[model samples]
Target: MRTQIHSHLQDNQCLELFILEGDASRIRELSHLLNRNIKTVYSKLVSLPHE
Candidate 1:
């Protein structure tokens, strides 16, 4: 799932904002929309490069 999202983000730059912000609410919203677990989303977020 992390790989999938990362690939998607790499393909579309806009998605990077969500990861860059590191906002829990936005993460939760994305998780819900993607039907992915919040923990999984959170884990992916932490793995993102820091600005």
Candidate 2:
């Protein structure tokens, strides 16, 4: 599943997924949506080392 999802992440790469309400269902639904749209899903990691 991860491989398939990552494959489609090239066109629409999103960089955040905040499940503050702790809803797994939402994530799953989002995953499905992303796949349906062939969009990339991104982890909520909001910082990079200064170059």
RMSD of 2: 11.6
Worst lDDT 10-window in candidate 1: 11-20
Q: Per-residue CA lDDT of candidate 2, range 1-51, in tens?
A: 222221223455434444233345665676567666634433232233334
lDDT of each: 0.45, 0.42
Q: Clashes in each model (backbone N, CA, C under 3 Å)?
A: 0, 1
lDDT of 1 at 19: 31
Write the residue-wise lDDT of candidate 1 on 1-51 in tens digits.
233332344443323233335566776676566546432443333445456
Q: Judging by lDDT against the true structure, name the best candidate.
A: 1
Q: Name the runs in model 2 displaced over 4 angstroms.
A: 1-21, 38-51
What local lDDT score does residue 22 receive in model 1, on the 0 to 100 scale? 58
Q: Candidate 2 has which clashing residue pairs, if any?
A: 12-40
